[model samples]
Target: MSFRESVATATVSRSVHFFPLHLRRDLVRQAAEDLDRYHGKAAADYWRSTCRGLAADLTAKGCSDDEMREQIMDFQAAVQVALLEMHREQLAQG
Candidate 1:
């Protein structure tokens, strides 16, 4: 069963195994832009909601932790790619 890699990956390293953090630069950038007009939890809330929605989508599509373990570059891999993109962008600017 091939799981669709809809969202990009972000590697939030806490172990040798990569976490599936579905964070895309465009999505995060849009979230930042949308949240820029707000402050505090309002901004945080947007990100929280976005992540939740993405998680839900994965679940709805039957993307379980077990399935993640099976795929080569599945949603789990996407998580790392997403974060790496963000970190790269930050580095480029600095």
Candidate 2:
């Protein structure tokens, strides 16, 4: 499936659901902005490492692969939306 399709169908993981909604939104927004600051391979590398780190962290906290998968998918969708909004705002300001 396409990234957009996957994102559109993404669900919040139970593990991540423990976090308050505001905190989750803040984390995703900050991560999205950080990822968007990079160019070319740097961006790809950052995203890969971020996902790996997230998986590792969740695993350490005793989360299952299914939970990790959902969290990752949810995170990806949130970041993509955040980045799109950022770009839209930038264009509007210019």
Candidate 3:
């Protein structure tokens, strides 16, 4: 599968609450980093596109802009935490 596809799959799978919190977070962070490495600016563009789609969909479903922004912020925060954890894991492993 493509990088985007893999990331989407990992995101969806983790969202179902099947994985442990740490593992899910690690997977997300790794997926994001791997995508960024492989696709560069395109990866960031994809993230923006996804966030925009998310906002638009939420708005269409009657969510307010503030709510949408908050949701996105929460997602970003989670990603940041996961990324940090991944970095730490790499350092420890090294």
Candidate 4:
């Protein structure tokens, strides 16, 4: 299903929520660092901790858990798409 279609079908996904501009700018940097640091062979616990940290950060920033879940889900989708594109580019270059 298209991103729009899926989001439209889900009640909580009705809108794209962005962080405050400066915080938004930091998000990609944070995600990259967290993913790079936490992702690896046998790194399940590491990744889980990273996700927990992210949720904590959201909570500290005053996002409700439901709101955090919705936004994080959307963020994950975007990150997956970005990773796919990077992989495709690497394969093409190779």
Instruction: Tell me, by TM-score, which candidate is best.
Output: 2
Candidate 1 residue runs with Cα over 4 Å from true position: 1-25, 66-94
lDDT of 4 by residue, 6-91 (tens): 87789665555547322453564455445645556535675466567777887787687798877666665555555566567779
Q: Which predicted model would earn the best lDDT?
A: 2
TM values, all candidates: 0.39, 0.74, 0.55, 0.56
Consecutive 10-residue window with the lowest summed lDDT within model 3: 15-24
lDDT of 1 by residue, 1-84 (tens): 233432222333222433343344455455445554567988678656765676666556666655444432343345445556
Q: Candidate 4, after superposition: displacement of residue 5 in Å? A: 44
- lDDT, residue 34, candidate 2: 94
Off by over 4 Å in 4: 1-26, 29-43
lDDT of each: 0.52, 0.79, 0.63, 0.62
Give me the overall lDDT of model 2. 0.79
- Model 3 whole-model lDDT (C-alpha atoms): 0.63
